[model samples]
Target: MFFDLALVFLCIAAVSQFLYFLLITSNHKDFVKRYNRDFKEFRPKVLLTVPCKGLDMGFFRNILSLMRLDYENYNIHFVVESESDPAYESLQRIIDRCRDDMPAGFAKVLVAGISKGYSQKNHNLLHSLRFAPHDTEIYAFADSDTRVSRLWLAHLMYPLRNSKYGVSTGYRYFIPARRRFSNLALSSMNAAAAQIMGKSKYTTQVWGGSMAIRKELFEQLNVANLWQKSISDDLTLSAAVRNAGYKIRLMPRCFTVTFEDMSWGQLFEFGRRQMLITRVAYLRMWLWGLFCLLNHFLGVWILPVAAAVRFAMGENDAKLFAAAAVIHWASLIYRTYMRRRTFEFVLGPYGGYVRQLSMWEFLLNPLWLALMLALILISSFGRTICWRGVRYRLNGAFDIERLNR
Candidate 1:
């Protein structure tokens, strides 16, 4: 009776949590249409600070796409470690192209020199901000890996005009043209993060890839100091925003598409690094995520175990176990469906990219779920992580020490 009762509870919990996850993912866009903040009326003088490293896919195209943005009053500041960096030449070409086609002061390329002891991106960004115009009203940050659409800037900046939102942010959708298992698994991992960070009401996580913050609130929170000491710039902004009692919003229609190629080892490394950072910055949420992932995977197989046990014992509750198994599979199927739907909603018109991602993503979605368990396991055991091939060991929430190889 105890086993039977436990099995029943497991099924119930599985279905309930499944529905809760679905509800959270569904809310990613439920409010996308209602926000009416317009960027044109404000016409804020925006400072776009793009701190770049190695130029990945769409290097020149992504940088040049900024020229096509619909917003009128904005300055593009592309910061790099140095002219020696591979990305610098592409950035200079972007600057040269802009100067010939647009006004003389439309774009500026700043070099932060090279740093081996501190975070290079932070150095590039903070130095660039020091030179920003005093009248700069907003700061826009982007990653070089993203392909931003023309309306990306407008959408990301629009909602910040509303006083309630302190930061406007958008995430990236990983789209792979090839259906390699590693690529599909990475795409799945990104989808799961997008739902949690962008959709869930419990927390409003911001992404640095595409985000905008008002200048007043930024200085008011001492963001520069925070960035100087932080491991993840986006999470630092999130912590600061939460401490200052402001919400970070997911901007509608502002999702950037990322096409970075990765192998299985690279994917695992990336996932582990991100989750370890979360474990450092947001311990409670990381614990909760670990528990949920465990429950989700283990709870999924409870019925099969019970059914096998019943069959072995010639138990009379065979039909009950079968029904529970059906509900369990149904719930998992629904969860997979909702994940695809989330891809479509957050990706907007660009969601077709997922369709081309992997047929296995549809038929063998469970493979990614298993890979997620592996991701959680890998993250659970890591103390140090590599960034741009440099190793760093955690000292605290915002501190790290360079690890000797």
Candidate 2:
């Protein structure tokens, strides 16, 4: 009887996951088709904002890649909080190189004073906005750690050319620097995130790492109004744009590359920070968090039990397990195909599998839940976060209170 119940749960879980996979596949195809059609003749004045803190890691390489984009009539803005930031020197080097190779307008570094914002990224961006060309029609915000394809800006801006579309966000894939467990975890999380966003109706929110918007709409939408008490500027801005009766498009053809050499501790902290912000800013998203919990439980624990039960019940356990495994594997195979095609799957063999498995592990582990809860507590009650090397307190309205120490 116990085995039968387990089997029932497993079957349900497998079927649900299979349906989820199908949804994502369909959405991905639709997104691609729409994106290709839209980019045919779309061109707009673009300002690419790269918010930087330090020149740690491959910051220069990422910046240089952006400078080399094949788009026309666009300027890259490197927003640094302080003139003495280590990354400022690297930005200067990239600017000089770009000026030497290209013309004077290819890239520019804007040193700005940090403003009051819970997010340092937002603070830097707000400062950069002052220097943004008034004639610029599109705003593309790219993180300093991210690298983009030559066509990234073209693809992202193409959708916004339509009057109905207010914002367009591209996909992100992790470029694993090493074959460490932490890298595997980050990669897996990124894949699952793509799957989730791809399948969901709220594709409005762009990944903070890479997003673009209509400058006129962004100014009219008044994102800073929503930024108040919103820990995540991306989500808040996306939500505001959508609420303003404008469409937000997600272009699957364009993707940004993120470094995947983050330590396990860093990954956990990042995830916790994200969850805390999402929970506070988007209550609806928090409501859907339960589905994630169930999905993880089914993937790791329920499916295995169902296979055992079917075998005990004289059912074709091999066929059942094979079918379920095929469904799960299909999703992985598609992602692996994308990774390979994009050359984003640089990690060694089993990189894709390890990435998928880690998500299951995170879901099944009670420890992760406990840690998340603890972080939520801290994010809610605690005043400050130690970011990079600076500590800033969370003010009443998503503004950061700089600490002396």
Candidate 3:
């Protein structure tokens, strides 16, 4: 009876997840339609602030892409901690090569020192803002690791012309540079995050890597001051926007393309650190993620064992558990198929950034979920996170102690 009940639970959860996927698809489709309706002359004076520490495999290409944005009337501020950083020279060369093509004052790299007791990303952002043009009307932020399209800025800025939207944000999907199992597994798991984050109704959370805010709105909320007091910039900005009673609009086709190659251990450690930050920054979301992890753990690991135990005991209803196992597998496979479609549709002609998906890769997704569950389980007990060569101990969303700087 217990095995049968677990089977019922598994089937129900699978169906619900499928339904959620459908809803997100509908939302994304609407977004795409509106984005393509027509062009508007809503471009504002904008500053794109990108913070860099180390170079990625696509670092040169990524920076070049940013330097060649299709948008008009925008200046870029690339902030590095020191002239000693590897990216400094590369950025200088890009600016020199692209300067003649760019509008006057269009791109400049700033050498700013780090902010003590804060995340490196935020530290760089603070300095970038210091050099922002006095007349800039919009503040845009991007991560150094992502490659943005020519129209990425236009899409992000178009939605914020409305007075009600406090922020506009974009999410990223990862593509593995190699066919290694570790790389495929991690990339497979990351696709689900992009869909949920970009398509869902939740506007309170933003992705720092591809986000924009109106300059007046940012200053009204004192976002720069807020960043100083928080651990993660995205969560801090989200909370401040909510407190100010403003809305966040998720832009369509504004997803950044990320290329990565990592081993299983590196991927696992990355997942844990993310969860630990979530644990401090957004406790409720962290707990909900943990619950989902536990549920997946049961569907993938525990229920099968229970089914086997019942079958070995000569139970006639053991087949129900077997059916549940089949349903779980089908759900994962189908969900992954939908995610691939989402990527291709959004990324468009540039979709090649994400390699073609293979049917066999979905089989490893269950293992990915299991490993993520293990990471979550381990992170639930810890408050310390080693990030970008600095260690931090957390007590709450904004309460943090710098263990190392």
Candidate 4:
């Protein structure tokens, strides 16, 4: 009787979760259409700060995509730790070739020197902000590794026109560099994360990779003061904005693409670092994420396990377990399909570039789920993480001790 009740409960949860996914996915599609139709033409003077550490995969291509942005009247400031950093020369070459076509003072690389208290990326961004032209209206930030669309800046900046929106952010969608198991698995895991973002204030956190804020509000909130001792830029900023009673706007059309090829070792390191950062910087979201992960694991596995146990006991209700498994799996698969369709619409032309990504994301969902659960579990204990060869011990959200460079 207990087993029967549990199976019924699992099936009900699976169906309810599917319905929830359907609602979010449908809302995302509608958001994409509405944003493109209504918010495509807001251009303001902007300062785009991109912090660089090392040569990431497709570094040159990613930098070139930024140079080719469709927006007008914006300056790109690429900041590195020092002139000796490998990415510095690469940025210079790209600037040399493209500066002629851009407006005068279009792109330049600045040296931030070594970080003293906080992350080097944070130091670099703070250094770059010091040079923001007084006329700059919007302060935009991008990561060095992701490739953005031509309209990325325009789309990212539009929502900030409203005073109620504190930050405008976009998430990354990884495209596998090779059709290998680990790369595809990482992409699928990341895709699952990217799908969860929408208009939900509870779920939306600012992603520093592709986020922007109004210059006036940025100074008013004193976000740089918050980042001065912080290891994380986005999470710190997210908390500040939320505390000020402002909403974060997640732009569906502004999702950036990253090309990646990770071995299993590299994948775990990356995933663990990300979750660990979230664990320390934003514990509430981390707890919420853990709940979702547990919910998903139980919703999918309870029936199969129940069915196997019943079959081993030679019980008749084993057939009932099998039927519940079919409904649960089918609902999950259809939800996955609808989510992918929503992403295709969000990505627009770039959708064609991600060949076989949907298939891999669907086929490898179970593996990624297990891997992600393991990552979150592992992150729950760690306070130290190494990012771009710099190791730091996170004492708390606002206290960071640099262990090494």
Best by TM-score: 4
Runs in model 1 deviating more than 4 A are 1-9, 32-39, 102-105, 115-118, 196-199, 315-325, 345-349
Worst 10 residues of 1 by lDDT: 29-38
Show where candidate 2 strays beyond 4 Å: 1-14, 33-40, 103-106, 196-200, 306-384, 392-405
**Candidate lDDT values, in order:** 0.74, 0.64, 0.77, 0.84
Q: What digit string (tens of lDDT, one per residue) describes model 2 on residues 99-155?
A: 866522557778876555456677777767778887888888888888776667777
Using Cα atoms with residue i matched to residue i, what is each candidate's TM-score against the true structure?
Answer: 0.90, 0.78, 0.89, 0.93
Q: Between which residue pairs do clashes occur in model 1?
A: none
**Top lDDT prediction, candidate number:** 4
After superposition, candidate 4 runs with Cα above 4 Å error: 1-15, 38-40, 103-105, 308-324
Better of 3 and 4 by lDDT: 4
RMSD per candidate (Å) reads: 2.8, 5.4, 2.8, 2.3
Could you give candidate 1's per-residue lDDT for residues 1-405 as a string of tens digits?
Answer: 796787677666766776677676556546544442445566688888888878788787778767667787788888887788788888777787667664213787788885444466777888889999888999999888788877777888777879888999988888874667788778776776665555564656788888999999999999988777767788778888887888888875677888877897888888888888888777776787777776677555666787778888898776666776776677667656666665665565677776665355667665667677777777777578897766777666777666742
Residue 14 in candidate 2, Cα distance off native in Å: 5.9
User: What's model 1's overall lDDT?
Assistant: 0.74
